[model samples]
Target: MDSSFKGILYPTRLPSFGRFPAPPQVHHLVSWFWIPEWDIAPGRSSRQHLIAFAACNLVVQHDGVELSGPTTRASHQDLSGKGWAVGALLRPAAVPSFTSRPADLRDGRLMIDAPDLLAHVVEVMGKETTARGAEAAAVFAAWLLERVPQVGQEALLANAMAESISNNPDLVRIADVAQQLSVSTRTLQRLAVKYVGLSPSALIRRRRLQEAANQVRTHPGLELAALATQFGYADQAHLANDFQRFLGFTPSSYQKSLTAPL
Candidate 1:
């Protein structure tokens, strides 16, 4: 697909952080030491162009950190070489690692802000991980931003449909999306069915469930009851049941997985 908006699309540089050399077995889809506390602003960092947004980063901090989402924190000493981060293929609504609030990144997208539009580009990043080696990270970033997906029309429509699912998973209807985007329900439905390989409703549901998988694990303060509410569940039981279907783990199990040692 024409992965323009999904892969690396811009030039990138390192922010004035530490000067550590690249790690061994270092794949390029992730840049070097995107160190926290560099004081980047709300907009994309100057070095943002260097990162392959479509790719995932499994970051392990040099120093330990107690990160409860963006702002919730604890004091860890020098978090230098802890290379653990999980990168997403989608442009998220939340501020990056350092900041809190979704508005920190772009307009601060809602939880389901990232649809599957970046999937193709994410795949490309996986392929380039070794071939391009260290350059893969930077190169992938440029690819994602330079153009729309190869199936440009299909991808955009599909992405919109997916976004619809994220807004309100259970109660979403084409009429709701029509109202939100200011288009007729029929128009949105037609575009989604024609290009996305699924009806708009189907796509939306899928996005909502997939997004909840990751989100359920993100908030430490959110116990079962609270997390269920955030994701629109009637109660903890309902949320756990859905969670098992989508993620194969109950909500509590999911949280435990994150804290479990390797």
Candidate 2:
């Protein structure tokens, strides 16, 4: 852990973690890869709280592999002992390649057994937990390439919609996104729910709150009213409500916690 670091609800940078982009071949299905290696001191553990994006993840630990779905609210994980994890951040729409119903796993997780699409990747990640940097990424990418052929067109479109949502900060309404994509609002909602495991409005809200959290962290003294207006919130209260709903903390309190000493 960074000694100077204080409490932060959404940690963009972790102390002993590494994230790498996926290779071109599987880029559409896989967003990025992450590895976290940690050795918590005796009688000590670390907990990280996060507002998970509208996406799924394939995580490999020493015990076995697990498929984690998108979370609707805040989630956390406790890190203890000497442990490590190799994780694949799957594109929201690409969830079908691994599971039939993305929404079924929302705010929940499932175990990966043999005879599934992820078995081979699980096998490889089992052996590569100690591999670092590009070596671990390469091993994961090679496995993903074999399964790329299974990704369908709906997943591709869903991934593109997710990209659009995350990239456009000014997007406030699902109707606006539907207009931009030349689709009806109902169609867009169906696609999002089916592929991304979230409604378009939910996705927009998640992205906006994420931006707000980053702004609060980077500029601790920034005015909440101004930040709220800048990010399309109706008012500071609206923003604070979202922060409380999704992050379990108000923006001001979150900033205060971050600035406080460890």
Candidate 3:
């Protein structure tokens, strides 16, 4: 498991998962490229759980490409055979090229018709002796640059908004993100809806929740009440409520699961 597993809930269950930084050419369009290659034996399965980042993903599998919209809650995928997938964690600036109404595709996915892009990635990944991480990511980034050659000013602003909310823990409120980005709250809300498929407030909560969960997993001895205060939750109960609502478990339960024997 990697130290930067912020969104992943159970690192022990993952297969050969790798996340590569996107090249500078596609920085405005992609956050990073993630690849997962798996081979499971007969009658076995690996289920990966995630409190996914509140953004879209462009995924390429052997079959086809698909555009995944923002998720409103926890999600999981069960892998049960030999397979590989190349995925780009798309930035807000890249969303419009794929969908007009991001909000409509919340917690959903749209199959895309990017045969050329899919073929290139698949071909790069199929080379047995080549190091697939950087090469595959480069191919994916190149395709993105070709597809979305230019980013508009408003789209860049949306990217900034998403980055601000995601990176700043002190930004617990929508107004904080708006002020930090020099935009009005209404404008922030509109940008979030158009680009992120969730409200600004939802983005804030997701980051907080992801951070809190990461802390709980990393520091099992930390007190819940103190953790809540540190993450801007009103109290321990509020933090527990968030964990229950989104992750389907209380903080203590999640902590205990981490130590449970296999």
Candidate 4:
């Protein structure tokens, strides 16, 4: 289970959210499964903000399923009524099963025609049990396993590229990632476009920004310039520019907002 709120911007305002690791059988296909259940008062709304991971997600809700592509900026969802969503943070190896032109679907989503999958997950979620999250993730993993039984070598390489860029903060440049993965820079770019929708540089930037924001929120007294140095930004101004561009607020403002009265 992943309890850390890595990409979520406002953990304090979230509803019931759970993130479970993918089963070993489907580990190559799915990074993890996340579920967010929300119930708001009448005439009020709870807005959830995020700088989503630089990867696609297959989300299953009450109505149907959706394949959400990678994002380039901050985004939010307003929940006004009772609802829940079971989402799979798909790995690069599994993206082709859902969409081939992932680059075209950047910052967008496509409706998936998977009624049986939706029904099965919904049934498991409706069950009265304490392990709804784990059970629902298991069923989701089972469905994915049935759909994508075998992963190709190139697809596995793409997954390796994504994992390298995401998990290694030292990989601040496309060349660094390419060298780490022992692939040419051109090959890395092609893999990212075909599987991740975002460029390798974009993925690195998103990871840095997310880490910087998390630090700002958790370590309110930390100097922005020091954070920038730690994250490989040129300076404090660069970090502030990233925050303003992606999150629409400077680091100081964000930190102040965190401690502000509601």
Taken over the whole model, the C-alpha lDDT of each candidate is 0.38, 0.75, 0.91, 0.91
Error of 2 at 63 (Å): 1.4
Candidate 3 lDDT, 93-182, residue by residue in tens = 999999999999999999999999888888988898548767989988988898999989999999999999888888988888888988
lDDT, model 3, position 250? 90
Q: List TM-score per model, in order.
A: 0.40, 0.88, 0.97, 0.97
Q: Put down candidate 1 lDDT per residue, 1-262, tens digits, no spaces.
A: 2222222212122222221223322212112323222334554333322112211122322222221221111112222322222232332211132233322322112232222323433343345233323333333334333322233444444445445554455544667777776678787776554433235655444444444444543445566786667666678898777656633557687567556653
After TM-score superposition, what is the CA distance of residue 156 in candidate 3 from its true location, in Å?
A: 0.3
Residue 120 shift from truth in candidate 4, angstroms: 0.6
Model 2: which ten-residue window has the lowest total lDDT? 1-10
Candidate 4, clashing residue pairs?
none
Please say which candidate is ahead in TM-score: 2 or 4. Answer: 4
Q: Relative to the unseen true structure, what is the C-alpha lDDT of residue 252 in candidate 4, on a scale of 0 to 100?
A: 86
Candidate 2 at residue 203, lDDT? 89
Candidate 3 ranges with C-alpha deviation above 4 Å: 1-3
Q: For residues 1-262, what per-residue lDDT tens digits would candidate 4 score against the true structure?
A: 1328988888989978999999999999999999999889999999888989999999999999999999989999999888899999999999999999999888899999999899999999898787998999999999999999999999999999988877888899999998988999999999999988988889899989888888887787998889989999889998999999988888888889888875
